[model samples]
Target: MAERITLLVGGRSTEHDASLHGYRHVLSRLLAEPDRIEVGAVCYVDRAGAFHLFERAPWPEREEVLLGGQTLGPGAALERLRAADSFVFSLLHGNEGEDGGWQGLAEVCGITGNFGPVLASALAMDKHLQAVLAAALLPGLRVPRSLLVRPGSFDAGQVLRRLGPGPLVVKPNRMGASLLTTCLPEPSPSALAAAVREVFPYDDQALVQEFIDGREFSCGVYKEHGKFVDLPVAEIVSSGFFGHAEKHTKGRAKILLSPENAATRKMRAFSQSLFEATEMATFARFDYIVEGDGIWFLEANTLPGLMSGSIFPMMLAETGRSIADLVLSAVSECGSRPARDKVLAYDISH
Candidate 1:
């Protein structure tokens, strides 16, 4: 029997549009392997957090097809998913989707698939916390010095005193895709304050860190046959800080796959180490900044983008692997795991 899979995409996050774009590519890839995989449904979560179920794989080329589905409430949505008995692979990014919110819900409702462990998702969401944990877990791990700033509590003078001087990167501590992320080369008090303020609209906290002037690279890791398989390391050459525009806009950045270098080996090792240490499920991608021999840990993505032109897919392609391989591996890995015992046993004393 073909493995049934339900793709969960779109979410109440800043990356909703990106999720939709990624969904089209992933859906197309999965549909191509109908003999081996059956896409039971495409569950779409709108910006307002409502669930829409598209029973038939319409192979939506545009976003409009996502609108023509039966809207479902949370309970109804869970029931629909449970009815399919399919592995739920979430493509949702940021916030409630990637930040342990959906994972926690799936755990509570006994929904299974690729929604990673709740604690790991939550840990990966917060940049500051992830860095702290990574540093503690891996001795001699180099991460940029950073400070967390919350609304109304940001002080530029204090930040400068702590992190020091120019070329600081300020980004939403919880958001990804470089949205609302900025690098101030001449970080004045006002400039730093404005950058931190921009993050407030989308996220509760901002991470201000010293910019690592080095070559940037990202590597992906996934499990196959109960063992870790690390993909080739890809180097990202961006004109600037690899912000939203640079990430989304073609020609703004160049991605080189499996670059021959010493850092490549070190990055793959680091990625695998972090992937295991954080208890990430199925798959993950880790970004880094390497200056000479010193490699700095940038961030971790439990759910890395799978859209066309995304680094994860490119890394997979370099290894003769496709999205289908990843999905199937996830199914096998997750399916073999022990199911959660949700039942509570108790005895009433006579």
Candidate 2:
């Protein structure tokens, strides 16, 4: 029997809407391989903590949407709980779902996927923490020493005195998709502080990093049951630094399979190192910047977007693998959890 694959999407992050778009596109691609997939389902969690099922009756084009065990609740919409044989998550650029919070819930209920536990998810979710972790693996990569500043953590004058750096990047600790990321150049400190206030609504903690300017590029990697699948490098060209509008708005960002320069190779090397450093399983996207003689480590997306034009699928296609095949290969590995011993029904394996 084909396993039921729940494509969890939409979260309480700034990228909630964008996550939905990613799910829809991924759903379309997975349907292409009818022989392997079964019971397609969508679970949407709104900001107010309300969960809703996307479709009531499966349409002709999407006849595999299973409603048997699915239900909506405050923060989760899941069926079969511990009984689910497998799950394929596609949450992008946001909190809740991608921030390791959702992964924690999955673990509590014994649902494992490509990535490890919630600890890794939480560690990889925030750009600042991920940067600090990458420092050990990708040596010499330019990373601004930073802090996870929460509300009332510091005063502006005191912060500047502590930083003592040329410029800084003030961003929400957990938000991706560049919602409130601001480049704070010196002599105009108030502008960045103001941007910080705007981001306060989304996250209680803000990340302040020394700004490093250079060429930005990203790469993808998929680690299955002891197998690593590395795809071609893809570069992100933005009018400015890759921010919210640049990623979502057309023509603002350019994602290509091949790089125009040698810097991309350095990016791939660093990406592989960082992935191993973080102990990331399944798949992820690593972002970087190249300066004169240094390549800066930016961050990694444990759950990189798998939408139609998203970088992960693009790189996979470059390797001649269809989205359908890639998604199955990644999702199928989640069954790696050791078979439960009937004698020890509740013995947990770490």
Candidate 3:
């Protein structure tokens, strides 16, 4: 029997649009493999957190057509998906989608797919926590000096004194896509405070880190059967940091695939180690900053973007693998794994 798969996209997160765009590509790829796979549902979650099922993959240019479907509650939607006996491939990024909420829900409901382990998703979501984990677990891995601060509770003067002079990057501690993220060349106390305050509207906490001036690169990894498979390292060439605009806007960032260099070689090795150490399942994308001999750990995306021109798909393409291959492999892997026992048995009679 063909493996049934559900493509879950969009969410209440700020990355909802990107998810919608990515799912179009995923759906197209999955549909191509008619004999081996069956696309059971193309579930779309709106920004307001309502669930809607699209009978077909909506055209990338015609996102407005999404409103045509009758809205269903989350419970109703999940129940429908559960009844189909389909494996879910979530394309949703950030917030409840990426931060273990959706993964936990699926686990509880016995629905599984490319969504990774719950703890791994949550760990990858928090920048500060990931940094701390990397520092403690991966010796010799250079993580930028960072401090977690909340609006109106952190002092800018102390931040500068600890992280060093001037140049620093301020970003929401838990958000992705560089939304509201800023870099200050010459950060004054007032300017730093203002930058941190800007993050408060979107996220409760902000991460202020000493900026590393160097080349940016990303490597992807996934488990095939029980072994780890690392993809080619790609260098991201941009004016400065690869911010939201550079990522979404076409031709803004130049991606060089399989760059032959020492930094990339080391990155591939580090990526595999990190993936295993963090218990990341399915697949993940790890970003880094290379300064001469030092490779600084930037962050990891458990749910990497697959939108048109997204980096993950580009890396996959370099290896002659498409989204279809990834989806099929993930579904098989999910099936091969032993099921988790949610409840513990006790000897009450003794």
Top-TM-score candidate index: 1
lDDT of 3 by residue, 149-176 (tens): 9867799998999988858999998888
- Counting clashing residue pairs in each candidate, in order, gives 0, 0, 0
| Pairs of residues clashing in candidate 1 | none
TM-score of each: 0.95, 0.84, 0.94
Which scores greater on lDDT, model 1 or model 2? 1
lDDT of 1: 0.87
* lDDT of the structure predicted as candidate 2: 0.68
Per-residue error for 129 in candidate 3, Å, reads 0.8
Q: Across residues 1-350, which tens digit of lDDT does each residue of candidate 2 receive? A: 55456665666677766776676787777666667766455555555555555443352222233232344674344444334454645564467767787776776666544435677778888777787777855665677667667677657666776778677888888877777888776725576568678878888888877777776778787764557766787767777767767877878889866744567666777777777766666678888776687878777788787667678888887778776665666666666645445564566799
Candidate 1 lDDT, 1-350, residue by residue in tens: 78888999889989998899899899888888888889988888888888888877564446677766899998999888766778998899988888999898888777887987899899999999999987897776699999999887778899999887769999999998989989898899999999998889888899999999998888888789889876788889987788889999999999988656677887788788888877788899889998878989999999999999898998788778889989999888877877767689999999
What is the lDDT, from 0 to 100, of the residue 24 in candidate 1? Answer: 86
C-alpha lDDT values of all predictions: 0.87, 0.68, 0.83
Of models 1 and 3, which has the larger lDDT?
1
Off by over 4 Å in 1: 340-350
Off by over 4 Å in 3: 55-61, 347-350
RMSD of each: 2.0, 4.7, 2.1
